[model samples]
Target chain A: MLDLSRVQKELVDCNRDKSSGVSIDLVGDQLSHLAGTISGPIGTPYEGGVFRIDIRLPDGYPFEPPKMQFVTKVWHPNISSQNGAICLDILKDQWSPALTLKTALLSLQALLSAPEPDDPQDAVVAQQYLRDYPTFLGTARYWTEAFARRVSIGTEEKVQKLVEMGFPEALVRTTLENAGGDENMALEKLCSG
Target chain B: MGWIKVITKESLLVAQREDLRNIMDLLEVSEKHARTLLIHHRWDADSLLAVFLEKERDRLFSEAGVTIAEPNVLAPLQSSQVTCNICNEDVSADAVTTMDCGHGFCNNCWTEHFIVKINDGQSRRIRCMFYKCNTICDEAIVRNLVSAKHPDLAERFDRFLLESYIEDNHKVKWCPSVPHCGNAIRVDGDGYCEVECSCGLQFCFSCSAEAHSPCSCLMWELWVKKCRDESETVNWITVNTKPCPRCLKPVEKNGGCNHVRCICGQDFCWLCGCAADQHHARSSCGSYKEEREKKTGQAKRDLFRYMHYYNRYKAHTDSLKLESKLKKAIQDMETISDSKEFSIKDFSWLTNGLYRLFRSRRVLSYSYPFAFYMFGDDLFKDEMTPEERELKQHLFEDLQQQLGANVEKLSHFIEESFDEFLQVDRIMGIRMQVINLSALIDNLCKKMYEFIENDLLGRLERVTHNIAPYESKGVERASELSDSWDSDDSLSMKTCNVDSYLQWDSSANGAGSSESGSPTDDSFDQSSSLDESGCSSRKRAKKEALDDPPFNLNLPAEGFDKN
Candidate 1:
């Protein structure tokens, strides 16, 4: 059993701390699956970008560490750019049951400011970070701008596009919102329905 | 000689308790605290005490996460509700438990934490749940709280704690028995020694491989892998078979003709291994080629070299297998001699000589592979000059040849039908020869081991190889640790003292050399008694053998002479 009460309590506790700039929200109806977003630390290449993380609480949650990975691809040494995987000791054998989702997210946020090149999830990025610092910083900043800085795709444009595909304007708007403001995805969902 | 003690499932608790008691007594701590210290230091009490001497007492205790709570402290008030930091839930005092480290968590949270750590296989050391608190949670509290929800997992926790003595301790190892005998062996001295388990399997304690004394553990490991790999067979296959030009399947040349036809209906020139293409009928492809000759020549040389060593190794192993059957024949001969009209009843020398033959034959078989590695370019190529290697090779081979010849002669003499000899003088002549050959073979084996140790391996600096010293009494059978835990305490105290064990070891070594004279007559008496008393005496004899001094080789010849 997942100890749903503790996870529920953790959610309430994390949300109460709005100043921490790290928050976890349920991804869907499932409490075990969550989405965590953290603002990159100030004065770093990742600043001004919101890094989305996919969080999964295994059944032995809190006792076993929660599995967290980068969802919004950010170029970093200790995180895989190809597939958003993290290399953090807290996520592995060093995980203590006392740690929670908020602390883990903070750790991941802290990792953005200081990447561990020696123990790397992305070998290419680690090599780049080790051999050429300026190039690595520029590439990382570019990746943040391209992928992580959420381009609020014009919601009005998606609503219009889905509505023109012959769905109700209200349904199109909800579907577009559900599809994260993607016009084509909202249209596909409308047509499939 | 280092003493190796076999610890059966029945004795594991006894073996571990002794160490725990020593730590408990020395440290003036509870059993749980002692166990924590012992488990941390890998059950080496001396090292744990050394750490105590080197560091402050409080530092040592705190470093291992041991916090001994002061006695006579009042319990926390039972009336108030407390909040568990883990779940952040307010619960009544009775619903929460406080560990000795003073970290309190609700029972529900504690059970959950214990379950998680146990499932993660970290049962031996489940720390208190407070962040940055390193104190290990008391085992009793974990057990009491866990068994409430899950009895089986609590049992698993106990098992894990019990098995840590073997799993963590370097001196102790589980017998590498398949279908596991549930027995572990502990060596009191040097780790590199041979021990026979109570399960009747003798293995090198260091590598857990079969007892191969003259061959170092590395050499034995390589020899076993090489034999299992059948590299020589593969070599022969590569030498004889050529791939078909069309299908690429391996095709063997069954005849002397250069034109060969594959089963796939492809014709190829055997010399060039090329598809026929109008060149097959002319036999022009048979012309000498340097490349082909060189490749085949190298393969031929490698195959011959492998065959030379493999044949000798296989020959002795086969002889050993065949000679094992001689045990039954010798037992039958003993029965015949017992019932004969003649007064000669004792045939202990025959049985003793037969055992010597078996032991020597095994040594002789393994010696071939040992020689293969010792003299070949594979291991010691740069260690010795070619001339030095040749000199050492001759010295080793001479001993090997002498041992091999004497072993064969001992085997032959032991197999003779001496009970059929009506003349007492003829039987005596056979007995003298068997005894003399047994002694000679034992001496030759010891000499060969000495040569291998001092002459061959001793000179090498880049590599260090150690063989289990030759034991004339055969691989030492590890005696069972006394099942009583109290005796183990004294035994461990003696082992820890070091000087006493050294004196005992030296004295035992002296006794061992003298006892290497002959197999004791008691074994013959026990076997004879078995025949007279049916199956019961055999069981008693086996029990007696386990308890008896392993080597009692100095039986008087007059006992056999009178018989």
Candidate 2:
């Protein structure tokens, strides 16, 4: 079984530190499924982007590493472009029970900054990264702009959008703030509520 | 000679125990640590020793995930309680167990880690649960913790550890039997040799295919694939058919002139395989292209050359299949001769010749494929000049032809109705001929092997092809691995079922050309023995003749004189 108490503890502890720029929240009521978000490291092609990761804890959680895949698309040599499959060692054979969802998300942020072109999940991206550095940099920055950047829509607009979808305005504002300014999350919370 | 031993499931422990014991004794380590070291080295003791001697003790131990904990570093926690980072729980210190690496985790977390790794088929090297700590967890702990919750998985873990000897070792290979026999064969030395398993499946140890010696594993592999593929049939099609210009389908001319109509209703000239209406007469179609003819000529010659060898190989193979039925006929003859009042009541020569025929027929068939690759431009084109290839081919083929002719003669004599012979001298004459021929075939087969190994393949410059040396007896049947048999004893031992006479025959005639005289001379000596002992001699000779054994020959040792 998933260590529900531990996962719950991890969520609370991770959310307590907002400065870490990595947070985990329950995707549904089940502790096994969660959504993690990591702000890209500064001075990298992926800077200013908040990448969402989908985390699913196997039954052997704490013993087995949680399966993490990209939810917000980002261009890098080690993350698949066609499917948001991240090829990180910590997610595979190198995984240890000592790691948690927060550390895994931080590792993803590190992977974004330092893309391993030699051991790549995306061959085309890796080839460009090795052969033409400028093109790889431009493509990664463009992908961050196109896909990973957080919506800059004002809190009032998100609240208005939710309220227009038959939700109370006060609840919409709080939900948008809780979702970290993610309009889609605010809409989902409003509809579910 | 190299020996083979069958490692059945029951004897697998014994098979691996020797290697484990060696590493354990030499390294002064426990069995678990020894196993970890062996497994890390893929059960290669020599290479492990080389590494042990060359590298630092700490490095060797650390590389294999064997953590020899520093005593000072393994101090127990002062407080009775601690927080286990894995589950983020505060548990009593008694609930936690510290590994040799000095990293402690709660029992629950450790068990979960072992279960996950075991299920993932990584039970062979279940490292510590602590991150970045490469220490391998103790097997005893794993077994203890796992068996508490899941007993079957613990058993699977033990089996995986035991089977790693065969799975990881280079010298041992699983018998490639269909619906797998659950047995592996371990050769003592020379992986190039062929061996017959206890289950009676003979295979080339190097390639694990059916035993095809006199031909290297590479040649036999290519020969088998070539026979299986439709390349020859395609060659036949190319030789006999022309494609229609419209549909690009190969069209065989049933019976027609050069200008024929295809079934697709397209009229084409067969010479150049081009469309021919009314006005398209013999413009360029009649003129032959030099390049096309050369290519086609080469293909035609290759097809014919392959046919020459393939036909002989197939013929001998088919004869072997048919002659296997002769065993029952020979048995009936044995029964008839037993009831007869003839002077030549001992028909041991008949069965001996029959065994020789079977052995030689196999050698004869596989030699064709050997010659095909040896002389042909496919494998060894650069290995030899054309003149040298022809000379070596003649030398090898002469031996092959002599062996083939003698095998046919032996087969013919064994097939004859000797049981119906009324004349005593006629039966005796046939007996002498059969005995002589058997020995001659055996010697010729030995010579052919020597020639292939020493003269032909040994002289190659760049590449080496090792064929299994010929056994005068037959393909050596692998002995069962028993507790009583040690490595030293197994080295000198022949097949467990072989009689002392065979031991004498094989060992006594090792490499003395003077002692290994003509086959007729050996037969004459055996006939003299037959003349002296009479009834007892027949039983002794029959025992020597029969392939399967455990018959007591009860004669004086000096009286036994045979090849």
Candidate 3:
């Protein structure tokens, strides 16, 4: 009845693409609410480990940006660790009807890789973020492994990674999403776009 | 696609050099259009638009909407009242908007709130007017609500509202302000403090000054309006301008020209309100003698009317200074007499009353010469080091300025820090004989009741810094390093990072240097409104001192403190 499917498809697509290596894991079902995994983007502290992400789409479809929360603990300027609520303009005050869930995930992946240190949602993280971007990356990657790597059977590893090199599963999922969900496509997307 | 002589697409593509560059400037053209154009015509970024222009005759001009010829399109109505969400301004009915929640507000106010994210081009997520539900509005309601009311502004501001456009943080981008420069700057929106144009132009968003334009939205509106009006006038006059009748050279006049007579024996007529032809109108009806007499008579009556407001502004400035002096003296007395000392309290009250009385007089003082002094309240508490309090006295002055200068130099400095701040303070101190020269100026201004408090004490405040020990004063030494952050999550909140925020690392005019200085440092002293007051309170304290002083004490009446 609603355009939820279209918006979800876009989220699925965006989750697969991005400069930040992205990975998505469907813990439960894909049509309703879903949990995804992403590896740490390269050069970021979240490089090695896996990170979990949750996407909750409303019935209104593309008109509303989906509510996404980081299931894994990772340091970021906009994301609050207390609940992993993000402070990106596109997701909150700037939610556009034109945006789909896929775009939101890709944006989140981008936010993870290159965070803003000026208008920080997290004051502490922002301080460290402005003072040292590299160090923030270190802890972010470390946390990704500590939390996101937990996977069992029947769980589809739909994660995407975009940025190559040191970027782990988080980027892998992002890459996968950007590449239209094909591993080779992911590599090609990374090399090209 | 070329409308000219028949030319193959291959030949045209080979001839053009910038086919690829033009796509970047197409603000309205979709990215898909660029891809299609590139594929079909093989046009590069520079010439894709050219190819489009070859098809859509008025393409680029139509996109930018450069046509605003009708100035009288809307007649100026009288006393129109439209409720605004922020204020009850009287705007036109067409400017009013009623939200779905039944809130009525003018478009101007909504736009002001909506422009919270300037770079992202997103409208501010305004809170509901209803007191009960203070929820931040989503774009859906704003679109539906504003459209039903003022469809024009809603449409105009809608593009500015990015709430849903760019989901998930794509990199922050900016409108390239340079000529022919269209690359969106992938900048961090957190600091959003500075914008470095691709042309290597740097500007501050805080002052609206070059390199860093930082005025608020209203000031920006005024400045932009002025620039636009000027540019429009320039462009219009340049296009259809009449020549200086005699010289036959095109002329553009900024000022009112009632008698724009040519060098030739021709008189221009102001009464007609239009340009005159070869046969010009006669001047003054040959009654120049009578008109001169009449104007001479009017001058006398207008002088008093003119002085009335001027005098009022003068009185207002004087009272402001007296209040500042009294307030400062009282604050110092109170701090020293924390245990409630009688002499300190008595002095504070005495100065307060004297300051108030002077404030009430609101008269022009022509006879009394003024003076200022910031000597250590050496007479006050013995336990607290006079040096610290006295140097801290300079702190009160420096708190107001980021890069302090002489008391006279005070008039010159407004926000721009020296090459270095601390050393400048020390170097500037050496120039002055006083230990706390900056404070000495403030004290001197207070003691002498000098006029131009902004010029004097205001400049001394530049070198002042809000300092806290890197490590806590207590045993924990816990940096709470996180405490300095604006939020636990934003990660981009850039406040409290002193090293990154406060620069001017160069030797501040040899400030700290023991040699080559003046006597202003003798009175150097300091306050920090509670740590919670923020840098703004300091700015306010300085501005308020000028606006709300208790007396018109113009010290150094005859250039005594002149730099």
Candidate 4:
């Protein structure tokens, strides 16, 4: 059995260090279960949306990358699975020695800008990505409003979401920043109790 | 006596003719006497040898005297061929002709003349007595001459020459002036005077007078005794013993020896040498042999007490003289502080001897002849704090500027002393003066540093400042100003020399010395003797230096002044 608590700490820092970020958490103190959140990168069609994600650390973490998945169903070719299983090179076999939580979050923000469909973990999202990119972005936004927007920021939110999770009260008051009005989705993190 | 003979041809001819003109021309001896000699030789100048035989024959007659033996066969009959010039007798073939003069004289006569001339202390310049030839005679003439022929005349001539030298110039001892004073003194050391006649005539050594003896042994003995008796005499008691009469070894009369003999075995006649001998004189005479049985018993009693006090007094006086000599030496010796060369130990010995001599000679028995009065008000000290010192700066400056500057006041001080001096107070004579001077010098030395360091320095600085800066402008002008000031100062510095001047000293001399020595005797150092030699007379101007100074305070903090 793997203790997933280490992934919760990294997921919390991912949100604090980068605004368009992703996070992970252990599920109910159970050994192999986790929870997380993901955000849309700003200035593109996905700017007004929220995304949910989940993660789990292996027993050998820091040597092993955390397992990440999309909790909110999305049509994004980069993010895969209804449970937020994401495939990124850093998380897989291609990870470098010097990568950290903040670098991982920044990498995620870059992936939103230029997603790699050919190596998509979701074949349906990848086909739609080749056929009509605008609709895939539209569906991805809808999924963020339908799933991640309904929740409050997690108590285990990353540093930025902890701030959104009421660590700093000012970030939570702006409805315009939360386009789907999903406080729970913005605040939810692997660090949630 | 024989002599060398010398003659001029003219003089010889005149003599042969019997002109006898030598005596007539003798006013100044204008003509020098020439010398001729006749010598006996191996050469046979037959005629000269014949004259020599004639002279010898004449000598035999004169020496033996003209005795006509009744059987006088050997006596030659009178023949007027030639007379021997020296013996006034007949000259036969034996008569010798004096070589240079060719005059014939008896051989014995010529020989004796030469010997007489040589014996005279003057070995040079003797000539023969030949009538015509006044020549220095040779050895042959000397051997031929005989003096016995005219012994009476020779004795007369010697006596005349001696009398003449004495009449001209030379010293001869003179009889003491007292008719038959039976003493003679040579006018050798310091001209002859009858005053110090050693034979006890009381005549002067320089001139014949009772008063001429400036000091006498008797007076010296009395003075010495009195000096030894002085209060300070106790400090120098050991020296009071009279020295040996011969060796001057101080003799202490120890044990039963009636006569004290020095280490050299010379008996010291103490009374004769010093007053101490009077003890022996009176003690020895105390037991005069009692004449009768009546006073015999009383005489013994008288003998016991006869000279007891006198003997004691005499002994005391002797010791006192030694003590005083020691004191005088200390007083008269060149000041140890005055000279750098003297060591304290050397000074002590000298002083001790002088102390002995002083008491032995009693020159200081009188009031000390000198005293000092210092007028410097600047004697207050800087080293000693205010509570310890008394002289203040203001008062000192006032005293110097006001009182000291006035010569009249100083004259009054001197006059006051003078008036007291005129009153012959014998008991407190120069003794008082010496005591006063000792205190004065000590006090002055003590006060001088205080004066110099505390007050004099500041005052002197002011005085130096008062001197105008003259090292500027032309060197000649600066020097000329100095010269003018120096001359003016010289005029300011003078004290009057004349007897009639009723003036006060009108100047402040930095360290003025009186030129006349004793204050009593024309200002010669009126100080009492510092010597065994008669009062070590010094002029008043001769100030003794206390120690060498230009004193660097680093040298044990003592101020020294150089002589």
How does chain A of every candidate compare to the true chain A by TM-score? 0.84, 0.82, 0.62, 0.61
State candidate 3's TM-score: 0.25
Task: For residues B98-187, write the lDDT of model 3, one tens digit per residue.
Answer: 443344456644543443332234343344333333234445545655566567657654544321121211332332355633323222
Q: Per-residue lDDT tens digits of candidate 1, residues B152-192?
A: 99999998998989999989988888889888999988887
Residues B1-563, candidate 2: write the lDDT tens digits: 33688888888998888888999899999999999999999988898999999997778899999987778776877789889988878999888888889889898899889889888998899999877889999999999989999999999999988888888889899999988899999998888888888777989999999999989999999999988784578557767887687776678998757888888999988777778976556488777666443224566678768888888999999999998887778767666656675455655556666777888899999999999999998899999888888998998889988988888888877767444744667676677677777767777888999999999989988898888888766777677676554554332232333443343344333432245566444433443444364525434445444435322212233322442
Candidate with the larger TM-score of 2 and 4 = 2
Off by over 4 Å in 1: A150-193, B70-74, B77-79, B231-296, B332-342, B417-422, B483-551, B554-563
Q: Which scores higher on TM-score, 2 or 3?
A: 2
What C-alpha lDDT, on a 0 to 100 scale, does residue A186 get in candidate 2? 62
Considering only N, C-alpha and C atoms within 3 Å, which residue pairs clash in candidate 1?
A: B344-B563, B518-B553
lDDT of 3 by residue, A1-193 (tens): 2344454455466565754455444544445465655665666666565565667765443334567777556677788867777788877656644345555666776777778778788888888777886777666655565544434322134342233343466666655543334444356555564
Please say which candidate is ahead in TM-score: 3 or 4. Answer: 3
Better model by lDDT: candidate 1 vs candidate 4: 1
DockQ of 2: 0.75
TM-score of 2: 0.78
Backbone clashes in model 2, listed as residue pairs:
none
Write model 4 residue lDDT over B166-273, tens digit each, in one string. 221122122344654333332322332222222334333332333211123233234345445642533233345655655544567765644566777776454444
Instruction: Give the candidate order by descending TM-score.
Output: 1, 2, 3, 4
- What TM-score do all the candidates reach, one by one? 0.81, 0.78, 0.25, 0.19
For TM-score, the strongest prediction is: 1
